[model samples]
Target: MALTDTAIKKLKPSDKCTATRPDKYSDMNGLQLWVRYTGVKSWVVAYRYQGKQQNISLGLYPFISLADARNETTKIRNDLAQGINPKDERQKAKQKDNLDFDHFAQIWFEHQQTRIKPHTFKRDKGVYYNHIKPLLGDKDIYTVRLPDIMAVHDRLALQGKTSTAHKVIADIGRIYDHAIIKGLAPNLANPIPRGIHKSLVEHKSKHYPRIKITELPKLLTDIDTSNSEPLTKFGFYVLCYTFVRTKELLGMTWQELDFDNCLWNIPANRMKNGLPHVVPLAPPVIEILQTIKSWHLHDEFVFFSNRGKDNVLSSNAFTVALKRMGYKDKMTGHGFRGLASTSLYEMQYNPQAIELQLSHVQGSKTVRAYNSANLLPARIKMVNDWANVVNEVKQGDFSTYKAKSTADGNEMAFISFLQSLRYKEQEIQDELDIHRMERLEVLAG
Candidate 1:
């Protein structure tokens, strides 16, 4: 019976045991709220589960309002009329705990933490906690659709974090897989299916701007003369000499440097290839190392963070220095590799030797697996020569220097021909005279 105002207001319990409603209360279909013998009022829905009449408690008074109780009771009645057991269905749903995207995401993050490096795990967690979780955390994992993912993508794009959006979507997909595997949610469609990123986001190529070979001397000189911080100057020197990745250089430690042997042993864990690398030090590199050594009394890192001994130098310090030198968009820390590689090739060093110095894989298939120990000597010489070349350029010595061309011998033939003509002008004139006489005779005949 539908609840009346008088029934709601005057609802009270009776002695012994009895169930009664106000005179104004009259409704059909599902059970209604009634006070028990103890005077505690609660809602009950009369339904059939597996062909037997049963009473399911909706909830207690005030907690489940009258309107909500009625609505829930109606739903229970509809479920019973369709030969469905509402109690069994509710139990099945309750077993899964109605896990939402955020809850399962925490599980996913914990699982990922074991598989990735600490730094990488921190970054992934930051993306989820700072961005993804706030937007879709409360949504049920099973109910999170493509539109919802796309909405996050669109918002992130507007905020100029498109690449982050792509990564977040990928993370969300992994979280869903975790939910499925753990039985927290059913196996459904991944919001970010294959090729979906292209339609929803624009792809931008990462720009790696390198300093011009001839301009290196002036640039380094300017860097040295500038009133920048000592750490900034040292970072620039390290980048120019080592040609290691920016992050690796920023994270360098005093333990990694062997001043006696003049070598920097970058450990495998910090390297992209997961292989320990040996870098031969040049005179200038050793000089910079000595300078850093004088400054470091007890710190483990060669580049110590200003904050404390435990931290390394900031990653953005070098980029900021470049920007201060008016090279904001013209060069970057990673661009040092490109400069070194191009300059080494231009100096006629063996390609494999240069690649080895850069810690790159030599070749494909069998050659890659076959690590040659003989290249160390050649790499040492190549690196030294590269350093000397950079020093000379930095000292404003451009005599006998030429811009490095990216073309092969065949492509350079025209350039060689043009250069040769300047010296062989008389020989070219005689050949042209002979050709002109032959053409005139043919015309006369």
Candidate 2:
């Protein structure tokens, strides 16, 4: 018999009640809600599970109208008719929706931001936004397969973005695995198949090309003396004097340097190792800083960018200068480090000193800590010698060059020897600083 309004009002407690329009009121029995005994009406559904009575609420009255309640209840009745437990089915569906690839990927990206370095995070974000998100943003977790990932790779290859496509695919696989571990998604299969990328695309080296140490002098001499920008010229000089990374030198500020003390304090954030490094200023480095100071004291950065309002100079400034000077292939901003390292070691400077200056990690747990003392005096001398050599080479004075072999059987005979010496000192000083810091920890403990 069809349920009427009068019948519903007359219905007493414990009376088994169901709407005649059960098909129209399916969700009411499936969904859980609330009701009160104070004549305050609410929607609820009663069901039996394994011979035990269970009651689930649909919602409150007025908000959930009679028509809507009937519709909800009818859906649950259809599920039950098919021998499906409406409650369990609804829970499974909710879980499946939450485990969708796009949903899990957003959560994965947020968690990854805290784990990687800032520069690395920036690169990953670029890959996500430009490649991965566009390709697989709407796809379901179960639907994504190896073919889909390979398709993305092929598309990127066609667009000349092979490297980025590979990275995006790899990142997607990682995000999927992360989701599976957190129980947000099912562990099905990694879409990125191994060897697929290697077979389809050619792998390219990421680092800048290293230049021959001997050719550095000729390269420096070839730079245009006339019509060269001061910052560009000064930046080259700084690169030659200090064997620091391009970003490190560009980020340098006047406050970090102590001219009277002959020291430059690079903060921890800028350093690759995330530790503060003190660079002992050689006379040439001091002179270069003074020269730049004479022109731009208003700006806090030692190397101010004329292109921007900030202290940082454009990254391409040095590269452009090299190109203009016709040394495009012969010398790069990073090649200066190689040039300095090789030259200094040839001059018989300590290997540890050179490695520390390059900021390379020493192979030991104890060596990596803050216990090392920075070899300030040795580094200062090495840098000063490097500056003298650079000046001589620039002025066309490599007449007294002699080739010599090191105790390790490595040959280090070249005009770039002094340039190498400056970097070697930096390396040694870094190790020493670590040792010193370790000692301090012991004392404090």
Candidate 3:
């Protein structure tokens, strides 16, 4: 017979002297309420496992009611049939309670800090604390469902923050996947779906505005004759010759250049892809650097600010100079990259050599390492040929010089021709400046 709640309440304990052992009233198979001489009542289960009789405490009476105790007894009977101990399962549950989502996420984030760049790590940590922690921080790792994660992701999309939403989803999946690998979240699938990005509108890639190759000569001539600072004029030429990004060129230091070897090694942090890039110096680039070095030798930065030697030029300074020269939106500081990439490909240079000089990342890690090591010779020839082709663009003459595309192309012959002309013009500008200074002094006298 099963025990009723009223009948169990009415039962009294015997005196300690009379009944030394506790009295038990059975509800059904293995579920019992044991009453002590002191009137303390508790629920217990008795079952046979591996041909051995075992007993486990469920809970105190009232907290574990007669019906609840009976339900637990049924679950324990199933566990015993499956060769598992109910007591051990309960202990595991208690341990899992400590490994919640928030706790494990912090541990995972700390481990990630050592592997990624400092700025990237800072950004990820900001996202976790600001967006992720508030929504799913307290969820038990084993109990977090797919729908719960989807709710957070959809909310971000609705708020028009698709990029953040995408990163958050990836971050959550990574954390959960790590947890699963460590055996901390068994039987719990990663809640973030693989096709989650499909739900949000994709971000479009932006390309900078650039001039056509035919019009490049006119633009270069305007830059050379512009009434702006001489340093600004040289800056425009360096961008054309090197085809490096604006930040990489503007922040260049004197120490980064190897004039003897004709190479410029940009450091990892300054590069957009966070890798060191080697640029072969063309004759055009070397001439511009030599001119700037003669004028600003004390400054550490190649393009030092007008205000002080310790400071570098402003990022917007070149853009403002372009607008003054009437090339607003016609060309940008970044446009040189596109212009060079397209023209070089048209000129039939090696695609791999051009890409390496542009510092564009491609191929697998192993393949990229091999390609980077062997690209220097090809790149040196490519840069020299490109410089020679651009050097022939006279202000009034639209006739283009067809560059000789060969590994052994001679740009030195063209460089020599241009060097004599450049020196003659420099002498004329110097004489004019001196004459003007003398006239001003004569007027003062």
| Candidate 3 residue pairs in clash (backbone atoms < 3 Å) | none
TM-score per model over all chains = 0.63, 0.63, 0.60
Q: Give the local distance difference test score of model 3.
A: 0.74
Compared with the true structure, what per-residue lDDT tens digits does model 2 show for residues 114-177? 6766556656766766677677767887788877777777788788876776676678888878
* Local lDDT at 250 for model 2: 86
Tens-place lDDT digits, model 1, residues 196-254: 77686764545477766655777898789888788778888878887988778877778
Candidate 3: how large is its RMSD? 23.6
Model 3 scores a TM of 0.60
Question: After best superposition, candidate 3 residue 359: deviation in angstroms?
Answer: 1.3
Off by over 4 Å in 3: 1-100, 137-162, 221-230, 297-299, 306-310, 323-330, 364-366, 394-445
Q: Model 3, residue 433: displacement in angstroms?
A: 48
TM-score of 1: 0.63
The best candidate by lDDT is 3
Cα shift from native, residue 175, model 3 (Å): 2.2
Better of 2 and 3 by TM-score: 2
**C-alpha lDDT (0 to 100) for residue 389 of candidate 3:** 66
